[model samples]
Target: MNDYLVKAVAYQNQIRAYAVNSTATVAEAQRRHAAKPTATDALGRSMTAGVILGAMLKGEEKVSVKINGGGPLGTIMVDSNAKGEVRGYVSHPQTEMEINEVGKAVGMNGLLTVSKDVGLMHPFVGQIPLISGEIGEDYTSYLSKSEQTASAVGVDVLVNSDSTVKAAGGFIIQLMPGADEEVLNIIKDRMKVIAPLSSMISEGSTPEQLLEHVLGSENVTVLESMPVRFQCQCSVDRITNAIISLGSEEIQDMIETDGHAEANCHFCNEFYYFDTEHLQALKEVAL
Candidate 1:
């Protein structure tokens, strides 16, 4: 099934929740970054969480999720927007580790911080101790502690030892205005019983299905569904603009030695080549 996300109101609008089926999108990231099993699972969970958060914004507003795990996986950077576009990269995608007791990747020993920069609004920032070095708990901690919104977030990523994406997906549930005690209890109970996110997504369940299970079929109303993908907004022209920022010295060096410059974008791994003529053209343009 195509990767997609859904926004919903559950328990008669007492709660606001979002869920997503991001297997294909996460798989694309795993392949592009060549992430190992543990790294793949870690990065996939981050991307899934990022995608759902992105769906909560308005036009031109975006959220950037950064996890400086300080692990072999290094840092994970995700830039997502309201349009269901998500672009992310791991500082070290090739890292891996043996499965732990839960059959999940081990070695998270790191903190988590997510900074959401929405255009001109001073950029909302949230930080929390990395509860599990797993993406979801960190996000849950971030929301409950930093954002002051009681929330439950579950993210699951399954990766094969061969560096292949087995399954990946997640959901975020937030208590809305006037959320009652009973609603919270119902949500907690459902969250406790929900299946591993990967198992559901891998079985071809949509975001709606996941939410239905979490909120109970009778108490949920699906609002909107949008396609989500691994998207990057980097181009040769953007790279050229960045090169111009380097000033004349760097430009001259490239023109003199390599005759051209090549930059590999971290998000999409797309390389932008700046030939001598292109550099010269950029040099003449006014800042």
Candidate 2:
């Protein structure tokens, strides 16, 4: 099935929730980055959460998530827009470890930062220390400390022996201001008994079912559902504009030294090549 996310509210609007089935979305990322099992897990989890967070925005708003744990995996970065588009990359795509060594592979020794661009003069930034190096807990911490919302985040990815993603999904449930203690206790109890997000996803649970498992079928009222995918904003036209901005001198230097210029996008790994003739044309336009 194609990837999608669900927005919901439970307990008469006291609880705000988001859930997603990110299997295909994350599979595309794994394929693009050639990520190993550990890198796949880290990147997949972050993208899942990032996309959900993006859904919380409106219009052209965007969010970027950064995870640096000082581990072998290096840094994991994810970007998502309010339209359910997400793209991400891991610094070290070949990092791998034992199945149960998520913390070690993620190394709880750095920070998690989230930046939001809401068409403001400056984007809002939130940073928090990594408490677990596991993506879910780190996100939960960020929401609580940075966003000041008490939230429960569960994100997981199942990787096959061949390093392909078997399943990827996650959920985020937040307690709004004035949330009653009774409601919080009930949600907590339900979360304790629910299966891991990856396990439920592998068992073919939809985003709705995942949230129902956490918030109860009777309590959750689905608000919106939208398709999500791996999308990047880089393109030949954008790259051409960038090269032009470098001015005629830089374009001429490229034509003289390299014969051709190759630009690779880190987000989607798309390559754009400009031959000598193309450089000359750009140089003519560069003022």
RMSD (Cα, Å) for all candidates, in order, is 2.3, 1.1
lDDT of model 1, residue 263? 92
lDDT of 2 by residue, 89-172 (tens): 989888888664667777889999999999999999999999988899999999999999888898999999899999999989
What lDDT score belongs to each candidate, Candidate 1 first? 0.80, 0.92
Give the RMSD in angstroms, all C-alphas superposed, for model 2.
1.1
User: Cα lDDT of model 1 overall?
Assistant: 0.80
Using TM-score as the measure, the top candidate is: 2
Query: Which ten residues in a row are the worst by lDDT in model 2?
Result: 97-106
Top lDDT model: 2
User: Candidate 2's C-alpha lDDT?
Assistant: 0.92
Q: How do the predictions measure up, each by TM-score? A: 0.91, 0.97
Clashes of 1: 0
lDDT of 1 by residue, 41-121 (tens): 778888899988888888888888878755667788888999999988888776666552211342356656666667775
